[model samples]
Target chain A: MTYWDQEKECMARDNLEKLQLRRLKETVFRSYAFVPAYRAKMDAAGIKPDDVNTLGDLQKLPFTTKQEMRDNYPFGLFAVPMSEVVRIHASSGTTGKPSVVGYTRKDVDTWADLMARALVSAGADKRSVIQVAYGYGLFTGGLGAHYGAERLGASVIPASGGNTQRQILLMQDFGSTHLACTPSYALFIAEVMHDMGIDPAGLKLKAGIFGAEPWSEQMRTEIENKLYIKAYDIYGLSEIMGPGVAIECPFRTGLHIAEDNFLVEIIDPVTEEVLPEGSLGELVITTLTKEAIPMIRYRTRDMTTLSNGECPCGRTHVRMQKVLGRSDDMLIVRGVNVFPSAIETVLLGIPGVEPHYMIILERQDNLDIMEVQVEVSEDIFSDEVRKLEDLHKRIAKELESNLLISVKVRLVEPKSIPRSEGKAVRVKDNRKI
Target chain B: MAKQISVFLENSSGRLAHVTRVLGDAGINIRALSIADTSDFGILRLIVNDPDHAYKILKDAGFTVSETEVIAVRMPDSPGGLADVLDQISEENINIEYLYAFLGFAGGDALVIFKVEDIKKAREVFEKKNINYVEAQDLYKL
Candidate 1:
């Protein structure tokens, strides 16, 4: 009924810098007293807590990585005691072991507030009925959005992903005003809504907060066009905090990082040297106000840039560009580095193959061969073996032209490939190396 | 010589039409045909009047057409004829993946399309027993 975007932070540069310095000092001191690992790292660098007097000295601190967190495992680096932790969330461990993160009661409240701030930034208010369709449980997206909507004093509908028909039915019956889920699922929901003959524009929904997977601007435009709502991007890693670490304002320029709670830095991915603003590199985050599992200069592996320039929506918190790709997820195919997201963009633009597909890399005779198994739907007319074979050849040729690498194409039945409610696994490398 | 071409197809509506259109354009006449379709992918087995020519056309058109050996057994349309042939193949330890009758009652005999584990052994057994084998010309006529 009513829409009110939250007031954006518009502090002057000098004042914001002073605030960040003060917070950085408190964070270093707290880490020295509570987090022994960080204290040890700082001591090894021959620096004391008092030595980091300014933000410029942050570069002197040792950088943490996902591997480091995994090496510590479970609760090894938790700054607070077990009694202080009220909740836990874990990253989807498709590559290796799952990295676990803990939250104290205050930390949970902080996460809720940040998520609520994200919802408000997307133009939701207390009168809005929010539907959170992200996966619940160990995955943070659902609860992160759930608590955030609740904190906004809105009517929170904890839909929690899957069962498209039911999700749509609730959307219609409950008059849900806000949606929170992965961008892919949001598009799928839009498709379902169209099939059900429910006009998405007529729905009470005003905005959507989509994340959990890297999506393109094309996908954002597609989802917004289909759903008829203003779409926003919410960014966070469970290791740092849940989905509220940063969010896109109405301008959709870049995600404004919660500088008061998290300090963001960009460094050359290969060289590990800190880069000037606007230069794309690996994103490094340091939790400035977290109680449990307080991290110092954690290398996120996410590729993006940080800018302190004021956004049109007026959030002065340092903004990060939309994540281009993940460093670890890049695939080296025939000496050419390829990201699955790039492949996804190409696949979605093609007409024949459905969105569901699998890229399999296998070693054959000391050479890596890429095989793409695409799902064929009713749109494809060929049922005869010869015709199907011809289609496969055509698709392979198209992909070869686009990717600049030869690939074999296999047509599979719809829904044959495995589906995931969380992060979908698109690339499967069977190569021993 | 007649050609036997194997095609890979997914089972769906209008698929047969699309495949027929390609062969029809190439001026190839199907003497006999059979299908081995699962829920996922299907294999279309065809014996064309002009085997070599049809195989080239389909292959050059980017179809994964492979040559396979299939037997053409002539049997009476009555009930015991197919049962007897199956029993004989079973005794010879030859497994039949799929089979279909090519010619109808106009020929007074049914042509059974068959795939066996060992084509040589199955042919030998059929030959030694003097089972009537349908010729390519006779099949085209039917």
Candidate 2:
């Protein structure tokens, strides 16, 4: 019922946009002056700091992508000197090189307040026992939630992650009312509790702030039903002030983006064109007050729809739907942008073709070749060779027309494609470039 | 009503050999076999001693397989044997999708497996035309 920063959270649209304009100008000026990488990019785009006259001028600035962050690497993008920056965090870099980010002392304070605001919105207060279980160390989740809990005057429990049985025991004995963890880990803890024959009703857990991974509403219901606690979806990336970028309030509608700190924009992932409100697209955020890393229009690649409708909870900050998918998987083949999901949609519509497929990209004679390997399932099988060949040709033609790139369709043996445990690797890029 | 076993195989090497090995492991003897192929894939159709068992084993081995009712006609092992059968089938207006030879000459008689559009009509035509076809039990014995 109460907001951590009521004035900023419930500001009028004009006032919020005014504040955003001011912060955007300051952030652009600072990045242009201090960060060489950003200055060059802005200069290349033929834009100056004063070119940003209004909030709408954000579209004119050059977009920053993960590749840009990767290029910057350790301290190349830092706006402040190392001495002024207090803490540093690096992503696990599960794909390539780990991206590192630094936080100035004041940036750290701003992050803590943002996280605190997020926690309070998700029904945590000073009297609550907040268990931060989103991992510690270089991962921003654990310390991010921990510092926020401390700032809220809540009893802090730095449980980190893993050790499911121990997490349950602490929850039971310590009387923790609020939990901050990844949604999957929260379910694991519930499973361990069920196996131990412990009743969730006996514990005092009220809600869980779950993030770091995209989850479905069904999983939220499963966690809520099994753990007997309300589950909230929190979203953030290590590149963008960690776990406090946005969080779902008790209203359970959408995660309210902390617009005061981070300016949010939804853009078409293909054209990189800004989409109108409520249209589903990629989320691009610009860090407004982050002095250590004043990211100017950093493309988050996260796909979500935005809503500017007034929330019943009275938080006037812009709200983003739970992340739908990642545009990071968007592939550019022969000057044509293709989404595997679009191809998948086409695959499902065609009869006799299974939805299971893998997109393989290889460079041939300096041209990008995309080959889709589809399983020859029994449904599409025939004793006549020409029929099966027709099936192959049809699939290839369909993919080519839908993706606007020539595709070679190969039918492999049933269940021959290598499958992974979670989030199956749909695309394999063998290009040496 | 003999049953023909059809297995889908990819163009990748060793896929055909792997399927043969699986059938061999199951001790399923191939009475007759034929392959219809394209550059991308092939459908290996076979008349085996036990078609149901072949279908099960090939499916268990993760190969896409299917079964269709086919008639194996036994005639004298001569130059005109297949021609005579083809003439009779053409007179009956039965469109044969495909046909393949048996593994070996069975007692001076040859067997040819035919996949037709209509099984019941083809079998009825064979009966009226006095064409002697190998029974399902007799094929299993061979």
Candidate 3:
């Protein structure tokens, strides 16, 4: 199950640098010759493929944002003809239009190769029976992990998301060796397994690949303790060819980016000035080897930093810190940028309230107010309106102190809110744009 | 033939007690009661001595209420007593979603409040079996 290019896969800094330059040159020349839009952009920037002879010359290119990608819509930025596209995946459009990405057969193979490498880097091997529970279709998380497990010569059970009972049954029956899904879903699966009186350790899951949404290190430790498995973070975006753009090795230091195929950059989002390495800034990427839709300096809007220091693991690829937060997803509550993850941390720390809650934002009298509706356990309090109001006030005061914003709290009964199998929608913004 | 009245109440606290107090003050006795709640609201099912009067009293007090026909089957309070009634209903292909029960003091009779899919068919089964059913007046005495 070893890679044919094992030496190349673990290339040293000098060798990796040479490999990247060759790939970058090929990609730029291909794009300038084939893609009219890319050629026009390069022409307007007064830059040519021959001009980008060194890595330092990448800044001469223009940056691509999610809004720009969405504005172009489907197949608009394809470097190759539409006939060469083998697959297309899109992001979940919570705010506006979803960003669409197209891939050629070669691009798909490269994606699977990187994903397989990622899994192997995370200790997966041929003996592993990987159970993929990410949502399938349109979204890349499921298929991306699926192909990787297959490529790694592992026994892959593509048990897509939801059907918790059936998922548990398969995990037990098939003795799944690896679990892949969102961190929240992994915890949810563990909860269901406990409720069903099934020991998660007995199911034979040895490791997990959790991604698709950002999770905290506290949550990672909690999940690892509960599932009794080593959890690795796999990062990717559909716009960047799905899951396997980067992955965390066993060192758990940071995700190692496949810089040979993709060049990573950190830029100040407001000023568009590229930041020095190790500086936290918006993550921007450029696909050096992709053919169908070769993105040049695509602004991910995700905040993180790049590290060139050698990892404890012998790999020489650059490392990226876990995504802190999405700039677009940040909520400006009374002039303070608040992320939902921050609220989740404070909420989970509180007693008497379940993790399931909703933050409703409404504008009243030209001022924005947030209402947090938390589900209380049946034993928490008696069924008295006054007692419920008192509990609500307590929760409101606690939230106000933690979030630094006044929040109206409402105590709801258990199972009052709807459950989601994919990304959980916790915030509802009703203010006028 | 016991009378049944449906009481609508908001899911706030002490609402059930308030409704019970109104019936207790009027000197009207409650034979049996069942409550269904969806958290935000609740429907109180009552089998009373006089359902029409109870409904009017609650309605006059600005409470939303209604009256619906529910079977009041009288069975022997011994082994296989309720099973006999259910067996008869099942034999006639009547579906019983839920039911409530109260044992009579004579040690031989019991009253069952049943919410069935087909009320007419259930009543026919009881009538054909010659089962003694309680009337509204009998409930008032209890």
**Best candidate (score: TM-score):** 1
Task: Give the Cα lDDT of each candidate.
Answer: 0.79, 0.86, 0.79
TM-score of each: 0.72, 0.64, 0.71
Across A120-199, the per-residue lDDT of candidate 3 in tens digits comes to 98788888999999988999999999999999899999999999999999988999988899888887787677667888
Q: Sort the candidates on DockQ, descending order.
A: 2, 1, 3
Please state the error at residue A388 of candidate 1 in Å. Answer: 8.2
Better of 2 and 3 by TM-score: 3
Q: Higher DockQ: candidate 1 or 2?
A: 2
Clashes of each: 4, 0, 0
State the weakest 10-residue window (summed lDDT) of model 1 chain A: A1-10
Q: Is the docking of candidate 1 incorrect, acceptable, medium or high quality?
A: incorrect
lDDT, candidate 2, B22-128, per-residue tens: 99999999888998887777789898888999998987777889998889899999889899989999998999888888888768999888989898999999999
- The residue-level lDDT of candidate 1 at A269 comes to 79
TM-score for the A-chain in each candidate structure: 0.89, 0.79, 0.90
DockQ top scorer = 2
What DockQ does every candidate get?
A: 0.07, 0.57, 0.02
Q: What fraction of the native alpha-carbon contacts across the interface, defined at 8 angstroms, is recovered by model 2?
A: 0.90
